[model samples]
Target: MAGLRARLKKTIVLVGMMGAGKTAVGKALAARLAVPFLDSDREIVKAASATIAEIFVRDGEAFFRDRETEVITRLLNAQASVLSTGGGAFLAAHNRQVISDAGVAVWLQADLDLLWSRVRHKNTRPLLRTANPRETLAELYKTRDPLYALADLRVSCGADYSIDDMATAVLEVLKSRPDVLEISRDG
Candidate 1:
């Protein structure tokens, strides 16, 4: 049987709601760990040759989600890397299963206040294209938090924290969890 440390060394995947700082933390974490970083949403945008808003306006959410799954699958099959997924990436059971099987998933958590502070100005989030952005964010957070908890690790990503600080904290947590690290390495 593969050791825990080996199974968990494959990749570090950051999963959380938007404004939880997945991209920022994933980049910092990858740099700290000396690995490449990939944002699944960015990959999807590049592949579709369209922004997320455009995708939602044209192809709709289901189409965009299918594309997202494809991008995530490819990323998981790649070499060692840090992957940051969209807010909704882990909501799908298939996507979550892929993440669980292919990498160590970390959930960067923040309360509604922190999330509103970070994303209130971000016009790019398709889900936030609403009359009441804060309410939408709160609703999304309520739905996503439970799914995020399904990840292998969870870290509080408060507004007071820096990406580097969060990255270090995640590393510390991963280091202490030899069983998870082993799963990622050997997966």
Candidate 2:
């Protein structure tokens, strides 16, 4: 893994739904790769001095999304590491273009049921604060899966997979992309 860390040339951008374990698996993946772990949402919160939910309410989704793009672009340009993006961040064409140009986007694919199970109890998700949150999640799953498919690579997440397991899966996927990650045979 140390050799793998040395060979990493691009940032691994995790793009997926809120409950897709981007943050959790990203942290583990970064640890495994011995690189920094950055979250776009966390950066946004830091810059705004408010939570994502508050940002959406105070500034509006469009405003929040603009900030998200700026943060992502800045982070991707800085260093090679693992970056977890907000669910809707990849939906924007400009954001996708920037991510493709600067890093490798890896979609953490999970089914609606699995996503719902993971995020149902979370109050931090601003988009899931609807009257029918499950249905809303399903709708988001339907609409966003196609855009997510545009990612450079995809790693499926299952109910049986732990965070570390998912991180390993992402690492395996990264191994296939030589431009993004290179694995030394002597390691």
Among these predicted structures, which one has the highest lDDT? 2
Candidate 2 Cα errors over 4 Å, as ranges = 1-6
10 residues in a row with least lDDT, candidate 2? 1-10
Q: Model 1 scores what on Cα lDDT?
A: 0.85
lDDT of all predictions: 0.85, 0.93
lDDT of 2 by residue, 149-182 (tens): 9999999999999998999899888888889887
Give the TM-score (vs. native) of candidate 2. 0.96
Q: What tens digits encode model 1's per-residue C-alpha lDDT throughout 51-168?
A: 9999999999999999999999999998868999999989999998998898878899888898898899878888998999899888898887888899988899777788878987
Error of 2 at 5 (Å): 6.0
Candidate RMSDs in Å, in order, are: 4.8, 1.5
After aligning candidate 2 to the native by TM-score, how far in Å is the CA of 134 from where it should be?
Answer: 0.4
TM per model? 0.90, 0.96
With a 3 Å backbone cut-off (N, CA, C), the pairs that clash in candidate 2 are none
RMSD of 1: 4.8
